[model samples]
Target: MSRTLPALRVTALAACLLTGAVLTHPALAATRAAAPSPAQQKLDRLADQFYVARAKFDPLLYATANGDSRYDDQIGMAISPVVRAKQFAQYHDQLRQLHMIARAQLPEKARLNYDILEFEINSQLDLEHFPEHLLPLNHFENVPSVLANYASGTGSQPLTTPAQYRAYLSRLNQLPAWIDQAIVNMKEGIRVGVVQPKAIVMKMLPQFQQLRSSTPEASIFYTPIKNLPAQFSAKDKEELTAAYRQAVERIGPALDSLCQFLESDYMAAARASSGYGDLPNGAAWYKARIKNNTNLALTPQQVHELGLKEVARIQRQLAELGPKLGYTGPANQLPQWVAAQDKFKPFHTEQEVLDAYRKIYATVDAKLPNYFSLLPKARLDIQLEPELTRATASDHYTPVAADGSHPGVFWAVVNDPAKYSNVGMTSLLLHEGVPGHHLHAALLKELPLPDFRKFYTEHPSAAAYTEGWALYCETLGREFGFYDDPAPYYGHLNDELLRAVRLVVDTGMHAMGWSREKAVAYAMQVLGYSEARATNQIERYMVWPGQALAYKVGALKILELRAKAQKALGPKFSYPKFHAVVMGDGTLPLPILEAQVDKWIASQK
Candidate 1:
């Protein structure tokens, strides 16, 4: 990836050719107006330099994160702690430079440049808090585990050619060292309190063991190698067949070694306490995480309270829908109804499930113009989750590339038809498909932001605002008259209630110090979620604290803003206009999003 331009900087070129702030600025030189100042040119060059660096980083980061290996050569980019530290300093320095230049020199549309700088700085700063390299592999999210899935010729890892096949072998070779370092970091985490919960570690045991069992061809990840490209020369095919066998040899043993260490050593000493607060200074660190993710100053208690209030509000809405369907009693019966409804049961086959979701997409796409004045340029596709990782994955959406080379993918984890609920698909589609994440993320990608702002979004990509908007889209089915069936309508609310339960249970687990049993029990009892589902979710929260809280917190904030916008504008408010205004800004901090809508409303008035 190119980090530098030949001589002419990217920002300078933009300023000179695009802005014409340089040569004869039609007006500037005509009025004898101040020619482009020397400082302006310098700032332009600097901005261009940043863009060039960003352009280089964008595709590489994308390739890697998306599971592509175009930049495998850069895999050791952060290998050394000293180099990592230097990278952190470099990030801070760049952020400082942008802060000064943005506040003083850049134009208004370029505000994203500064915002992205802040995000990058925060990311780099946060990296120093834990020595994650010490523990390169964890059960919850590790390269070995992920690569096993990737090598299955599913997900983002390409396996179309012999070269790509070799790439996988090479990456597999790197796993042992990465996992070794990961164990060390995890040990450090244990020393300092950053370790994963025993429950999550338990789940990983089965997974790594699954990796350990293999005839090379029998392994789940080896499926693609077994089905090598038909066009490959016989020699290449034979060589690839051998490569797969070789991969399983190293990969299988490495996984077994790591699993043994984690199971015998790490899990044995794992914390009895589950919350991030239990770690050393974990309380303060969690608070930082809360701030980082929600972009709100809310205490856990406040967020917890918000969840309770939202639960009540949503249950009431669900009750209204239930009565209309001639199913009455308490409103809370819907999740149970969601589970018990025969019509809502899983499809007999995977294609049935895919078709079901695809129909939802088509239906929603047809009606999108009814509710949205703006639409994303990127397309969305429905695909099964990668074989390597499907068991753990629920449905998820990946954003389309900013350049539109790829379409947004809505991955359905159809590993078990038994657990799939007919009631949940509506909410899943509304949130993960069109008019939800696909729209939100793709639009954010395409927005005319700085190269930095355009691509890099981590946990705090403003989940509440983004995810909240998606949740709100779930409710919009009612607004657009698309919830033609009571089951689908309730399906949407069932998921809403599920999220509400998360508010209670996530806070229950991390902030309130509830044990896994207590958390799972409360979920099953109050929310009607099954024990298995509850166990998985509880373990998930155990591994990644404070993440589940973001969904409800984010959804409520968006709902709250929508109400304010509607009430403030009263008769003048238009749903389409309101949606456009809210979504027009990609992902803003909750308060910043509030200000964004407030400004939009004031202008409308």
Candidate 2:
């Protein structure tokens, strides 16, 4: 998952107010003159305070990807015991303040804000019981891997100005200390019997090896110095380059040290079990992830059953398409056969793969206005992922800065293009680019809210909100006329079916104690996934737990809301307005999103 992209803030489309005779009516004029209620006034002040407090405490929250320069110099010690204690204190204080608010007395919008804040505070407090910092480094997401990417000059941390370069250099110098602390935390995790699976620990080895370059100039950290802005004075450029090279040299030992610790100390202690079910409080931890990721109260068993039914349903559909694709095999074998077809893998070179996706973007962009009344002002950029991580990386989207300073990127992993297919590229563009993450994220900044609402990039416990919207956008291809062809349309189904499989397989391994092999086999049988793909997907679920389930859960909720709105409005239903309601607010929990849709439905009548 490309979780690094900052949400873009586009210019809000102007809405014409209800004008003419209504404005002049004496009764309406008198109503408009009334002041806000006392509870509403207090709620407004609290909201402002809450937003400011978050920004002040967690500077890295916004500065990480949004190109917010305010916190550029501060490399927050997110794992430090002192920092954790302070954060917990803040959470407790905020919760106390939140409890004092008269939530019932406030307006609906303010009440929703209160609910979101209350949920966020309590969840943060709940999470404190687990020592997450102890088991921080994973193959999927960790500080070292992320820092390596940021240093490569292509990631969210911008290095355009000399000051920006210097700021990052300060952050760069913290690498050795950070690595030392991580080793200590890992040692603690091993002592507490909370280590990562050996399978994932081995995956981290290659990443550490990648970061340990022989020289400074050869390192990814030298990227900014190499591409220094032409406007810099010769003396300043020389000094900055030297400083950056020195920083990279210092970081090399840290990378090597961490790598050595993992190989020598951590690897032997790492557990063999793949699921969270084996650890102490592992079940409760997994459940917390389920709640946070889906933002719903569903039990793991319920989600598991839902996934099983969805997989069966999608498999039945695949059987229907099997004969159409000239396959007469049993339904169980159909996925393997479809995956082996030569027609799907047409691109021979990386450029060919890039060109195919570019064409898809062009086609989708042309027809977007037909379905959406509001579109992002920012355009999308298609790029290939960095070569080091490309093989294992998923095709993902990274949002441009909200100020439109940077363009939103749809990064496709292009290693071994022969194994990859163009069949799903169009659908991929729809989900990652147009109506999916790019459009959804880009429009967040244009909303009428405080900086916290637009720029608070940390609350992704609402994964369902973000991933679900993108997944839902995948279905729009059919309505927009891009997936009329069977191949592309099936691509859409394949993606959807994969998400459905995640709900089953994620809960299966973590909650039901299914072996990794069993889960992989099920995916290959049902989703037409190759062994490598299936294994990778299952392993992703193994390490991340419930994160993958967010897509299907969220998309289903959004789809349900759309269906309900359509039924309520009948022929009068406006798809554009419905979308506006969904994207109008920044990312939200499904229940709040449903309430928003219901409110819109009522207003329509």
What are the per-residue Cα lDDT tens digits for candidate 1 across 116-174? 44654564466466553443444556556666665655444556778767777676666
Top lDDT prediction, candidate number: 2
lDDT of each: 0.64, 0.75
Deviation in Å, model 1, residue 186 alpha carbon: 2.5
lDDT of the structure predicted as candidate 2: 0.75
Residue range 46-154, candidate 2, lDDT tens digits: 6676655555454455455543556656666667767778878877987787788788887655676777677766656767777777877888777767667777556
Q: Which 10 consecutive residues of model 1 have the lowest summed lDDT?
A: 1-10
The 10-residue segment with the lowest total lDDT in model 2: 16-25
Model 1, residue 535: what's the lDDT? Answer: 74
Q: After superposition, how far is residue 556 of candidate 2 from its true place, in Å?
A: 0.5
Off by over 4 Å in 1: 1-63, 66-84, 123-127, 130-138, 161-170, 213-224, 232-248, 325-334, 402-406, 570-572
